[model samples]
Target chain A: MSEPIAGAPNGEPLSSDRPPAPSPEEAIRPDGRWLAQVEAASGVKAGACYGCKKCSNGCPLSFAMDLHPYQVVRYLQLGQMDKLEGSSTVWICASCQTCLTRCPNQVDLPRLMDWLKEELVRRGQAAPEEKVRLFHQLFLKGVAKRGRVFEGELMAGYMLKTGGAFGPEAIKNARLGLTMLKKGRMKLLPERNKDRRWLKALFREPKGGSHA
Target chain B: MPEVSYYPGCSLEATAKDYAESVEGVCEALDIELRELPDWNCCGASAAHSLDHRAALNLGARNLALAAQGPSPLVVPCALCYNRLASARHELLEGDDLVIDEIKALGGGYAGVEVVELNDYLSSPEVTALAKQRATDLDLSGLKAVCYYGCQGQRPPAVTGKADYENPQGLDRLLGALGVTVMDWPFKTDCCGASHSVPRPDLVFTLVAKLYKRALDQGANCIVTGCQMCQANLDMYQEEIAKQMGKQVYLPVLYFTEVMGLALGIDETPKWLKRHLVSPKGLLEKAQLPRQTWERL
Candidate 1:
């Protein structure tokens, strides 16, 4: 019917940055505006969150998370970046969107959380373990190389990174590893490639690359 | 004159041969050429990567390289295969230079020919126009389906493009045209645990609960998916979930392609459909195909 309102609740993808690390006076609903931008971009949320916890009920990882989906939306809506900034909520999200889909207010919790996490990482407020960050880095890095992810090389690099980064934890999952290999699940190494230059050329903007 | 490089992945070759057969028929109807990549191996699917990432990526890379030998873009009907190939392509292109160099030492230059998920490949406006032109008069207006994208189709939206990586209903749109009703279910992209079901039935039960309950809650008679792993996991694990949860929730799962094939009126009940632990025969009823004559086909 009527153009489902062209942009997100607030508008289109925000071309602007975060609200200057939340000044106290401006902090009342600081994270709110930028998150609204992200919510708009995702085209899922039509407006800002009103602190509803319906998302928490279906969340698989709620107990393990430091910031609940509702809490993440609230912090952003309230301009509380300090709480949203160093939050473990982003990584804890399976990016499942269960909460967002179930939210009555149409608040896109994942997009809001991811937007905050990116801001936190970029600004050095959130110190994600270099090892854990490897997963995120590898995904983007794969895209920059092939205009898509190179699973072969990525898996190899990921394993090496995982083993190097989390020692025993990586090894502790060996039973899973054994199961994978038995079922022909494990690959010994990655295949080589010849199109990095073309892939980089195809990217609109290298997301994980250096500062803009 | 159109050609598609086909990567049957592991399932179509081993457990789902009928999918390959039905796909071959559908490809013919669509006038899309299906070429099997030479010497393609396992995609390292969920199994390879869970055990070892490099090996899985490399395994997927091997398939991409083989597809590269052909002129057509690779079309993988299975979601897991597509994600694996796409992920492999991403890694080979963006992975660490030193490690990539090491892989180069073995699998040869990956050639970097593009590999496309079957849905992504078929999703071009051109293909949609073609399907509209070729579909038989099945008039499937009543089939309510939960389009299960599984974990791969959407996610890291940065890679899969604008298709709402989560609740992608593009296929549903196509189905709607053929007269099917799509159910809005939240389990569209939840984990079916893939091949892990064999070794970890416990984990699968939880994931399966999420899948069936959502679809059941949505009043769907069947779940449509593009990934073989999704079908196998849901179809095979539903009973397991039933036994564990002590509740009977049976939702037939079918490859979205199979539904398309049936709706298009080529319903011989491709043998692979029978391979599924969950019965998807209700699709024929959904497709409204004349039961007696075609059942013999």
Candidate 2:
């Protein structure tokens, strides 16, 4: 069985040779003001964006958004968190980090974009969109139940939650769904074991729930 | 023997059980002790970054912490999971102002836990020496394979470090060790539309078609991958693509471990290879290993 998972800080175990990180209270806004009081702890840099627009280039859903990838970082730099989160720009990033790899400065625009999305979700102030919330819920649901995403089951569950599970559309997609089921692609009962209970305990027992 | 914390991710447990089995079998062969981490979470794999960023890091971090409970580095089998976890590790250690306090927020965080890819582990001289020693009468001379690294496996080479992000030829070397002829293919690390199949099947058909066209044109009998998502995308979505294209494209997808098993003759069986959406039974027949379909893995 897999072990009780830790947070992001636990993933990279740098040796003593690595340098220590900056404090959240030390971070400055793009306006050069001390704005670390309410800042969520993260390693995303507000600068280093070269304005190459590579992230938008690879984003599959970029056309559906109001702002582009580099633009999202620009807004964050200008201390415009409201616009960053209000628009669908951050939600559609795909978090593929394409721009991060291509950036001359190695700017992690996707990471910053993701941080903005989490803040919006935590504040319950996200734009009126079900896809973003549904995406987050599907991920957490998979983690809560079995600690991994069962794609076939997760999709149907997401459809059910988004209220796309019935009527003509459902009937139409039902054939595709049946094909999936017949292929042994879909599981009727999510394989739940005793370890799932231990996972829950580990998650809930973490200090402060580990979220900003 | 060094014991490393292993993350099976989601697919390996059930959907891709053979992968876990083969990995364990290989680990035993190499005397590599793999302690499956307890209370592990998903690596935030494909969807977490799109849904929420911190949650994705948080998700990756959680898994790292489970591995951090000991001195052993993380060994992830699924390339996608390794990429996500490794990316998360890179972010956490970048030492930006935010990571410092995020540590404080989550009390007593993992101070040191380096994430290692399974390919890095498998490609080690130690494991290779063991594989050579454990060699049986496995003749994989006839199998033609295209080593498909997929996007997450090879690219972002800075994060994965398993192979070159730009032009990875490591899998070819691994295949060479197994004595299988690998095709020179251009779309090795190309995108398969990834989890995009869930929301948009149209794009998946296009992506899979491109892959099939390139691999088939390059003379590959099957597509072998380190990612379960990629295997599923190529294997599962091809039928949908054929229906759309109004023709048949029968290029089966096989796991890299299965290919290694074929070469090493370690519990190689038709039933194990059959779970692939495309039955490699005929392909296995082409190789003609010693064990019948049922007597081995």
lDDT of 1 by residue, A38-92 (tens): 4554333534566657888777656556877777766655546577666666655
Candidate 1 local lDDT, residue B222: 82
Model 1 chain B poorest 10 in a row by lDDT: B96-105
Structural similarity to truth (TM-score) of each candidate: 0.58, 0.75
lDDT of 2 by residue, A1-212 (tens): 34435664767544445566768865544653312422334356656566777767866456556888878776666666656657877654445455666677776666666666666766667455556556556766676567666666776877787666887768756776675565445556654433454345434433543321
Interface RMSD of each: 10.0, 4.6
Of candidate 2 chain A, the 10-residue stretch with the lowest lDDT total is: A32-41
Every model's DockQ, to 2 decimals? Answer: 0.04, 0.15
Query: Chain A: TM-score in each candidate?
Result: 0.63, 0.70
**Tens digit of lDDT per residue, candidate 2, span B1-297?**
878888888777656665677777767766779898775667766556654454566667766766777557888888778888887777777543323233334442443577776766676676666666676656676678888877776656577654467567766777767777788887776677666666555666776787888787887778877777778888875776877777767787877777777666665435457566676766666656454742332
Off by over 4 Å in 1: A1-212, B95-112, B270-272, B282-288, B293-297
Task: Give the C-alpha miss distance for residue B124 in model 2, angstroms.
Answer: 2.8
